[model samples]
Target: MRTRPAGDEEGAGSSTPPAPPVSLLRSGRALLEHIGPYRWRIVLGGLLGLAGAAAAVGQPLAARALIQDLGRHDAVAGALTLLSGLVLLGAVLKALSQYVLAHAAESVVLNARSRLTTRLIRLKVRELERTEPGDLLSRVTSDTTLLRQVTTQSVVSAVTGVLTLIGVVVMMATLDPVLLWTTLAVVVLVGAVISGVLPRISRATAHAQAAVGAMGALLERTLGAIRTVKASGAEERETARVRRAAEDAWHRGVQAAKWQAVMGTAAGLSVQLSFLSVLGVGGARVASGAIEVSTLVAFLLFLFYLMEPVSQLIQAATQFHIGAAAVARLREVELLETDDAPPRPTRTRRRSPAGRPATVVFDKVVFRYRPELPDVHRGVDFEAPGGMTALVGPSGTGKSTVFALLERFYEPTSGRVLVDGRDILTLPLPELRASIGYIEQDAPALSGTLRDNLLLAAPEATEEDVHDVLVRTRLDAFVHALPAGLDTPVGHRGTRLSGGERQRVAIARALLRKPRLLLLDEATSQLDATNELALRDVVVEVARETTVLVIAHRLSTVAMADRIVVMDSGRVRATGTHEELLARDALYRKLAATQLLLPTPEGFTKAEASQG
Candidate 1:
């Protein structure tokens, strides 16, 4: 799939041409703009950097003066003292500057990570489905760290290097213009070589980071399905897959290192060649009596000063290349438009009138997961009016999609989803979600204390509220049996609990929300016959006071629903009580028969009747 530039914000369904790849320079500049809030701190750090540079330049001049006054015994001690003080002060100032810059770098990384995490949480569910967790994680963590180097150390070093280079040149010119010109010629040639290779270095680094992200993606995929991998006896194969990814990353890293080493060599060569040229020419001038011997010595010292900055400049450039590559990845995340934008301000909580269940209506709803995909719901029209309704269908008939549309997780192609006559699209997302409780087929749970997961939907729920839901869901006994009760830790994805217990816990969580409408998708699929019967009774009791919509394959779970909406291929084929459907709908009859619920002369067989 082609992607547009980082700044591009075209609609997902738009027909615009794909944009050209973004340049590293552009990404680097975008990262620089993110540093705006820390401008003052950066400026303070830069000032400290300049002060250190000033000290460096002063030290060379002090050393030159001390060397020139060697014959004057009385002046020697004073010169020595001045030179020693300049060296000591420069060291102290350099240390102070580095400390401040390091602090600023850490702060930028912290802030960048916080912002990325918040944005990641608020991204559109569809966008997130298309993105890998590990790639997103790399951008959040590794990329932000690279940005820190660019913001503090790289920028400061570049500026300081330029300043020092300029100061050294001015001093060199005073000693001898001819030698200075000769030195700059060699430096300029080396710089031309560097400029030619710098862009390639960035490209190599970008490739290297991409490799690392790929490795992370592989690791995440394997670990998330580790049980499956081991169960299939494919651990060795999976290990080989991860090894391949790691090897790719290592190769890319070596390629980047190769380019960086070339840059380092060029930098060192420039300084060394300039030194030799200056020394040879300065020596000839001194021999011809055109310049003083002491001046020649000072000029060579100044040449070494020039060498330091040249080395610093190249090092800073190398860092910029690496950082620019990381910024490209980071911008890929930062540029995407989030689902939550123009954040809603806090307002008084709105409550539904008491004694009324929410009415859900689908008015000719048509939807597909993607524009290019077949429709999941084609002009589908249905309503669940303030009571217990069960949606029954064959697999892939869009039974669960009905709930998804009601929740507005994805927009219908051309239709309306209304909650109590208000279009869900018109409702504030938070309020809309708050009014409805959803439990998915898998019933995922976070790794935390049982109480933490229970209170997630309703933090302000009282002890009585928690106790009531536990008893209602028949989970009270389970919780009480635990060693730590409410504080007992649920292992990752609730591995510590049986599947049936996890389902009950999910139900209890949804109950605490006090929602006007509750959606239960395959809620009892994992339960034993006894527990299923118990939960079915609980569902019936809850539906008396609120609306309940259940998507289920088990005929027993929905045989007594107030209404059964029989669906086929994304359309509602029939709706009525179970007996009516059994008599009138062939699909319902076949489904019931498949479950061995054959009709007797009076009604269903005794065993099937008992099952229902």
Candidate 2:
């Protein structure tokens, strides 16, 4: 599917570095702009890195001077004082820069983390289905975190190494142009070796991270159905599956490490080679009495300064690859447009306006799960006016499919969904959904306080409003029985509430919306005999004011409906009042005889658990 860029209001915080032209690894340098806001501070901390390198390099120069000026009283005090100050400055700057680097990298990582989180929650259902949950979680966690490490350590190292290397080259050129040329040639060779090894490191790092995401996905799916896993006794089998994925990650990490180690060793050895060349050439010049011993020592001390930064540079190069791999993984999600197309704040119905209450009309709608699967709905047409309408069909015959289309969870492949005569597709889903309340088959309530669940559709509702819903849905008794009415915790999926009670609570939530349309799919699963009658009474009363479309499994829902639309194989077989359908349709009679819900006992119907 095609997607537009995230609009200005929503699009922020996707900074990743561009490729570096001279990197040993093929991974490009991260762009300064894309280094994110946090990496900027890391760069600042790197500036102080020069001060630290100066002190270490200065020590050798000071040693050379002290020897050359031995017994020269004038040189002693000045050299010692300069050395002392350099040491002090380096120590202070080193501590400050390290703190700044760590803190700045953390802040940037946190922002990326939050952005990924918001995107995940807001992404369309279709997107979520396409991507692995485990991989997404890994991006939010492992991958983003690895990028943080690069910002703090790798980024700082690379900057400092470049500065120190420049300082060394300048000092060497001043000392002797010939020696400088020789050292630079060696630097080129070392760089070539590092370059050759880079692609392997990046590919390994990326693959390793992906393996970790795979492991996380496997665990999530298996553990999510732990009960089923145990009942089926497949624990050992699942464990082995995860172990294999983890092993793949381990192998990839080791391969990356091997390449990094080679680059590190090459950097360290290059320093020694340059140092050796300088010594041999300088010794011959000194033997001829053309160069002073003191000068050679000072330049050699400068060379040591190159060693630390060069090694750091090599390590940073490795980390650069890792961060790039991570960026590629994250870009897959970040680049997608998350904000759904703007739906109208208000609906535009397709049906022409009338004085009558709203009507939900599907005009010759066609739908298919896939191109290969024949249309589940083939130019099927039906209308549910404002009042109770029961949708009846045998299993696998599009009874539930009607609810899916009405809720706009899936649009009909062809034709239009018109509510109050306006095409629903034109309406903003959130606003459209807010106007049409849906109560699902299981009466699934989120894990939160009872009051929170009741206000799922409308949080700003008052206590009086909640109480009124309670009385109407026959939940007053449950409220009175609870230790804390409306405040009791409903465990995940309302496990704390019995099946019937859960159903009533869901109904209460729908009523709170004062919706123009209420679509219920198995909304009365938990209701016993008398409670079913009370719930049916509530639905019928609400239908008087608004449209109510129900997929009825029980006679109470059928009896309560102003009309019944019988469906079979995705087409409407007949439509009329209950008795009218019973007279005309064979399926309606069999359904009523077998599935009608009898009313509950009067006193027992009121025996509900109190809210707490």
Candidate 3:
């Protein structure tokens, strides 16, 4: 079994996977390009942010004028009136600007969401099986949310902050060049410190994002088997598992917080140093008659204004870390080569394919779950034409595994699986899968109306086709009892339907496909006699027109199969009729007597008595 991450400071140890870092700028550029459809909104939002920043700076300018004209009472009243108007105007513009920026950011988030979802669905089944469902969900939900934050606040603040920083710097130069140069020296030192810490902060943030993904995987695993967990009384163990993953996440978060605090405080201290340097130098220059008092006061106030931008700059930089972290997760999925699943290309819709019924042949085929291990289907050879065939085996005999290989979920490690003389590996997934209708034992029911579940197998199926299967499978009674009939909600995984009803639904779905080959795995495993009889009728109806390869369990189902192929330990052990195998194969006879044989209509009373 593949084990997920353990929540040990395990990472706190000497050897762990280095945290994913914000190490790729080219990837960042690619992200922007992919998200570029929302550029108009970003542009409009940026304009508003500039207006808001300018309005904010207007407040201090008005204050300076108010103070300068205080000695003249008439001038002071006029200055006070101007100040009130500027204040109200700035407030309104600031409010409107923030609104515009926020709304635009939301549009960016929406576009990103659509693109990610599209990418996810297009991924190959091989990858989906290899990847954890919860980790993928984290990318879709949590990482995308972080990306939204970056576009909204960080983009606007970065624009405004850079402008404000420059505006404040120019104002100081006019007051006294000597003081301005000293402040620049201090700013340079602070910038160096911030630069040194930024990579570490970004690295930690990326690890924090990955840790969230790890936690999602653990939660999904536990929740997926909640019934089994409860039955086994393993709730506390599962909880501890999740808690450990969460704690690992907490540690990564603490790493980011530590760096942020150190940088933020340093920014504040740097601003204070710049202010005191200006005040002392400007006052001495005024005393020496080299600078005017009013000008010095105005310059120091502008120096105070610079602090806002410096703080915004720091925040913008931190946002970069978060954005980089999110994009890295997104890219991990995006960069993976999609499985050979494209919707049946619209350009070619063949009225009649060259092959009528598929002739499947496996030529010395071999497969394994791991490349380093021995082959599961070791040099297997098989042939099945356009008719009914059965795969029968004991547990772990790789009967179900053969069906998986035929479906192309796993490729042969060597040799070939073929359809109509063409190697199956040569066909695109959709093209090959289109010709085969597969009914799994689980009989999965998607959350939707009954009609939706049925049509999923054949989206273009007609009403008459649906009605035929419903009646044939004895689902007509279930439909008539439900008020909404076909439109009635099935609930998640079709919990509202009984196991037999779910199996019938799967049959109805497969029936609609009009496939060249129908792959049925003991579709009636969960049903009683009455339901089993109805499904047998459905299988007989389907086998008439298509090749039916059934994985048989009960002897009743085995009796219906045209031929039986028995497998053991990944190799075919016997191929014969039920009577022939019962005489010669002791293993087959044992399996039939115990696990495979089902009581006939008359023999049921006797079989039930023998067990008692």
Instruction: List per-candidate RMSD values in Å.
Output: 5.5, 8.9, 5.4
lDDT (Cα, tens digit) per residue for candidate 1, span 347-455:
5443432557889888988888776678888778888887799998777878888887777667788889899998988887777888888988878888999999899
Q: Estimate each model's TM-score.
A: 0.91, 0.82, 0.86
**What are the per-residue Cα lDDT tens digits for candidate 2 across 1-612?**
111112212111111112222332322433232365665677678877777876766776676777677745555777777778777888888888788887877776787788778888777654665555776898899988876777765778888888887877787777777667777778788989999987888877777777777777777767666768899998987778777767766877787788878887898879889899888887887888877888787777777776777777888878887787876666666765564544544544322112245699988888876555667787777888688888876766677777777777667899988987889888777667767778888787799988999998877677888889999988888888889877889887677998888888889998886788888987886789788878788887788888889987877677768888887777777889987866666666666655554343233222221110
Best lDDT goes to which candidate? Answer: 1
Clashes of 3: 0
Show where candidate 3 strays beyond 4 Å. 1-18, 55-66, 71-97, 344-356, 573-594, 598-612
lDDT of 3 by residue, 216-274 (tens): 87888888778788999989888888888888888888988899898898899888988
Instruction: By lDDT, rank the candidates, best first.
Output: 1, 3, 2
What candidate 1 gets wrong by more than 4 Å, as runs, is 1-22, 341-355, 595-612
- Positional deviation of residue 203's Cα in model 3 after best superposition, in angstroms: 2.2
Q: For each candidate, what is the lDDT?
A: 0.80, 0.73, 0.75
lDDT of 3: 0.75
lDDT of 3 at 585: 61
- Give each model's clash number: 0, 26, 0
Task: State residue 39's C-alpha deviation in candidate 2, in Å.
Answer: 6.4
